[model samples]
Target: MTLLRRLIRLLCGTDPVLRRMLKYWAATCVLYVACIGMLLVQVELGLSNPAAANGLIAFGGCGAFAFYLLIRANARLKLEPDQLAVAQAVFSLVCAFWAYAISGPLRAAMLIMAVVIIVFCMFALRPRQTLVLSAVAIAGMGATMWWLQAHDPVRFPPATEALTFGYLAGALLSTALLSGEMSKLRSRLKRQKRELTEALETIRLLATVDELTSLVNRRHMNEVLKAEERRQAAGADTCIALLDIDFFKQVNDQHGHAVGDSVLRCFAAAARASLREGDVLARWGGEEFLLLLPDAAPGDARAVLERMAERVHAMLVPGLDGRRISFSAGLATRRAGEPFADAISRADKALYQAKESGRARIVLA
Candidate 1:
């Protein structure tokens, strides 16, 4: 059984819905083929007339088509809540009626098949839909049996009548319990899937963001730079500015790494505040950050970086013993047909000029 399960998993992809639909249709196809094969064998044994045997084969063929349609429908349709509800209801009715139609061991087999369908529907359908389907199955089956007994007597014997009624009662009871349990299971699975997806996204974001400054990290900065290059290459004007905390090592020595981190966070906050909507900011490296300013010229880039640097120099970092943080910025506009790396290198060189002249100033390269 475990080997068969693994084989099925290998044949199907990891998507739960696609896997289920594929398994359902595959199993249905195998079942119909087996039924046809059995009927053909029975005909060969002379246990049934050729006409009845052919008719059974024809019916099974028709059922095979219906299952094919079901498979096609599953693939083609984008099953919304209302559509799934309708499909569940229809399947439930079909199962119940199919159970009441067969006889003897075949009748028992149909009853079990009905239970299996109900269980699958219960798990796949929403709770409200499952409840409605369960009620529909029980009521429809019971009413059908009552009508058949009243309308015909020769079709069923005393023992058959008793067995049919017992089967109906048992199917109803089993389906109701199964529906309840499966509803809870479905809810739990959905909740767990949602939580798992959210956790994965949170981890992905943490991997991309700097924990100290909450800015895009160096890894994500590379991605952003690539994207910015593409955007600028498409005829959009852009600039790259490199900002470095002035005398950051001295600050860490005078204060502490905790206060240094606080200063970095404070600088990031001010930089973000000065940025326009389309500008991108990231922690390029330790005490160094990069900003990709879209649709900006050299003068605009210098003005924004200068204002940001002044803002960082004025703000008192609470954890830095009320000391203010200062930074130097190098502003460079995108040269026509220039690579992003070249532009960044020019801005980095200008930043060195800012520190060379004096700390806490902006230099345009």
Candidate 2:
């Protein structure tokens, strides 16, 4: 049980693609062994020359193992499709020649396999490369057939012209139609994958952002602050600024929550526009907003906060009762080696101080 646990962990440590390949190969090997066993039964029961039949079975078993190795190598190394296509085509042509020496029906089957190779090459390799490879394979097969006939004119007469014509015609027609369809499907699959990835990203963004204010929501902001703390621990300078709308509770009480909500959105838009592009802004909760500034020293952060407070104070948005709206702010820097929660507590304390002193000023802690 301990050994099995270790093996499971070891396998889980690999990339997802490789793990799938390993499972697939293991299943395929089991099926292959079962198939070989069935073939052995047929050899024993039906074949007159058991030795020759066994030899043929061994040859096929060796070829099957070789093909498995090729697939495993491509999966393990993540070889490009073009490389695999060339290797597959060469293997098919070689098998075709070997089958031609074995029997007529076997040769015909191998030719069909060669056509399948052409389809794969057309889909997997560049168009020009596929064309060159197809031409070479055809020429090689023709030359080999002609040489065999020439060497044994009496024993191996030229294949009937009609049969030869039929084979070539069938191979060419199948390759053209199947290869074209496969290429189209490949292109469609790529487009669908791209669209799915884009949709997933859009969903993730929506989940993290507040729709009304277009700022990071409370949950996302908490995550962001924690991540920023980790960065600070790695020697990054960091600061946090908190902002609160002055008399926000009174506005909602006097006007309506609807108008208060509009004011909140407007303030958020203004703040987002005024801050530097690098600043991270979030709706901390209620009427409070938080700004996380990576690489900002205490002085620089305070200066930015003061500017933002001035902007908020000067802005005139109609409140619930058509009055002006404004806000106060607090700024704090993360002390060297300080915990993230402590920095937030310090900033919250400074925010309360700003509220106590007056409603429209910036205080640094």
Estimate TM-scores for all models: 0.61, 0.53
Best by TM-score: 1
RMSD of each: 10.1, 10.9
For model 2, how does the per-residue alpha-carbon lDDT over 1-365 read when each residue is reduced to its tens digit? 59987887574445675455455445534644664464456555652245644555576567656655665566567776466557656755665554454443234444655565576567557655666667666766676667767776554467652365357556755565566676778889999999999999888888899888989987888888777777667535788888898999987887789888888888887788677767888998889998887888888877777677666655666654446667777778888788767777888888899999987877888
TM accuracy, model 2? 0.53
Cα lDDT computed for each candidate against the true fold: 0.72, 0.69
Per-residue alpha-carbon lDDT of model 1 for 248-340, expressed as tens digits? 998899888888887888888988898888888999889999998889877887778877877787888876766667888888888877888
* Winning candidate number (lDDT): 1
**Backbone steric clashes in candidate 2, count:** 0
* Error of model 2, residue 305, in angstroms: 1.5
Model 2 gets an lDDT of 0.69
